[model samples]
Target: MTKRVVHYINQFYAGIGGEEKADTKPFKEDGPKGPGLGLNGPLEDAEIVGTVVCGDSYFNENIDTALPEVLEMIKSYEPDLVIAGPAFNAGRYGMAAGAVASEVITELGIPAVTGMYEENPGKEMYSKTAYIVPTGNSAASMRKAIPAISGLVNKILAGEDVTPDKDGYFPRHRQNYQAEERGSLRAVNMLIKKLNGEEFTTEYPMPEFDNVDPAPALKDLKNATIALVTSGGVVPEGNPDHIESSSASKFGAYNIEGVKNFKDGYESAHGGYDTTYADEDADRVLPLDILREKEEAGEIGKVYNTFFTTVGNGTAVASARQYGEEIANQLKEDGVDAVILTST
Candidate 1:
């Protein structure tokens, strides 16, 4: 079956005015318009079923508000896949393409792809979320970029295996498997050959992260004794671990064993927000003071004295999980009761 593909572009590509039309809201159109024609013409099993255009600023400033509406538009079409820009280097356009592509892929369970220059900020922001082809810095490369995007769309719609070099695009961390055996031994031999200046193909390519199921809600928070966890790097004064404010090295658990109040002396190093609340009183974040108050008031069971803290920004998902697991194990061992984690 030919895949029903939808294309996303900014107002300019949709035949709307220049910067003036950048704020175009999504509306269903009967067929391709503007560059949508290029995509619709060559894509074989795919048709440009819908075009979603929004101002770059609109998407960035109003993402929370815009996403639902955009999603609602996409749902009406029921496209088999979604495609967005060969955005070149237009900053806002690149970001809009990536953001829309990622949301459709995740929220709607549809495959989405985008194209942008290596320098575009969106490349870094949404590269992990969807297919991002390396594009020329401007529309001069449109002919080349569109064909590349078209080829990848063909492969995706047909469920064919694709590679970075063969597809003429940067790797999106998507992995593919081959039938023939080329175990680590053969793979290292190939790598050694490449190192010695011989031609070789890598055996295992880094695959994009499979869609992650949202973290399951804490089970039985009221009865099962839920513990609070955050990567928001809420920590005590001086950051004893010297953990960087954004890129944390290791999480630390502050011992509030005998401390009565988080007043006067403590501080937070978390850089996401004004650390004042977390800093002026670490208790505001760890809420140890409040938790203790609650425990004393019989509002809850015993308050766990030591709570875990770590930097949330730029922290890898893997590192966060490891911290949680370690802290959870410790909590189980110490017989500390439920936890209430506060984020900064």
Candidate 2:
């Protein structure tokens, strides 16, 4: 019998709209929409019985409500396997895909698979819970992603043991028994190769490190301007920018000129922590009040009028680095001599 597959995709893939329509609720389509069409031939012996489309923002933002509703939809189809997006590196989309696949596997007791970029926050969070095939950083890799995911799905449906290296999925760090040269002998061989300056691959590779030299201390704090930056997600109440609560795609800049404290109309958008205190007094997270007091006492020259904020929870390093560079450039242009960055 042919295996039945239930496919999930986001609004963008469903031809609804991009970020603007990202709050669309979950809905179902017949079979093979968007990338699902490409998955058809590759998914041998399996047919995409239905396609479930959802908005990335909606799924991540309303996970508790959306997940069960989506699961019920998938369950109605009675699929043998559930396939979520090859979400690439889109943080929200990847997270949604990972979450859907996980729910299908755990709640519905069905096999599920999803795909994403290696560095996508979703891969780190859900790889162990669902089979996640690695794709490139964008949907431009859809062609490659579909085939890899479909091939893995075939293996999984066939009851074949699919290993990460062999199946192009992210490693879940599952230990497997393998016959190989003894560890001591392997170590000696590696050492011999190193001593002889011969090419050798270590069984374990050391992680690369990013080294940053610290800047010299401010020569005159009384005359140097300082700015505030934070990944704590503190923002004016109602969040004008719609900055995501998790896996934030954009950073916000707010004017604090002549402002003494974060009183009413200020709160945290970060979804990872308790918002009670931050909501009551956002100054606890950004500390603009304390900085202002210091400036008044001549402990610092001045506080820059603008502060940068973004949610750090589950945000991709690449996105963070981009935000950092942009924020730094803005600060430099404003003649800010130093910055205080906070996180939550």
Candidate 3:
């Protein structure tokens, strides 16, 4: 029997518009649209019964409302399987796709799949929660991504066993069945292979480093309201917030208004690097003293008084991204035009 599938995509793919149309609300079209059209050939017996197009910004900003509304639309089609984007490296689009895939799998209790690059933030946050096929970094990979995604969807809907290595998807790290050998035995066998210079595949693989594209350079540095931020874990003298030296749970905002030197009472809370030098002078890490000089010298405009700091060591990329986002939002609202970020 042919399976009915619902395709989810962002406004840009729907040919509605690009970032300018990213605020478009959730809407449905009768059949395949944009990339959904690419799926028809490879999907074989499965048909895209309806296409759900939502704006990247709107869905993320209003997820609570958007998710249910999107799920409702997909439900209208009564699809046996659901597919979201091969979102590439787009941060917001990847997030929306991952989210839709998550709900389709968890809430709808159906086979759902999305594709994205390994480094996409959405992969880090949702890959374990959903079935995510790894794709190239851009839509240029669309042709290749479609078949892989569809094939897996078909296999899942047909109740076929799929492995991460055999199929090109990220590992979900779920142990749904029992292993013949205990974990200790497997570890010992793998260790012996390692010692004997033999091949071994680890059950769990470490995640790749996150891909963070830096913001565009400031066109008007002399007029920009610059802010200071650090992952060096620099904080007040007494370590008031007690941000962990490693795997910091939270970041802190401190007032540096008109303060020239960190030596006044600042120190490094970072545990990754040697603290001796940073202890004597936090400026060694944050360099706010030099920034103040730049401000006074009129080389740049005003310095944003509120400086943000966090410890990067052993902190998950998800946590770091959350901190960066929260800090960025406040900085944008406060009219801070630019930021000088330092890391150790």
**lDDT scores for all predictions?**
0.71, 0.89, 0.86
Clashes of 3: 0
lDDT of 3 by residue, 153-264 (tens): 8888787898888887888777688899999999999999999999999887765665779888888888889999999988999889877665455899999876888976
lDDT of 2 by residue, 1-344 (tens): 99899999999999999999999999998788888898877887889989999998898889999998899888889999999988888898888999899888888888899988887899888988899988988888888888888999999988899887688787666575674888899899999999999999777666575788999999999999999899999998899998999889899999988888897789999998998999999999989899989989999999999999999988877788899999999899889999999997
**Candidate 1's TM-score:** 0.54
Which one wins on TM-score?
2
Per-prediction TM-score: 0.54, 0.92, 0.65
Write the residue-wise lDDT of candidate 1 on 1-344 in tens digits.
Answer: 76787777777777777755555666656567777788888898678877776765466546678777777877778898888887887666776788888898889998888888876767778888788888887899999888888888889888888776787666666566674655867877887998899987765656476475655565443334334455666656677876545434478877666776666556776655777566666666655566566656666655556667787654444456667788878988976445555566
Off-target runs (Cα >4 Å) in candidate 3 are: 208-344
In candidate 1, residue 300 scores what lDDT? 62
Of the two candidates 2 and 3, the one with more favorable TM-score, higher being better, is 2
- Candidate achieving the largest lDDT: 2
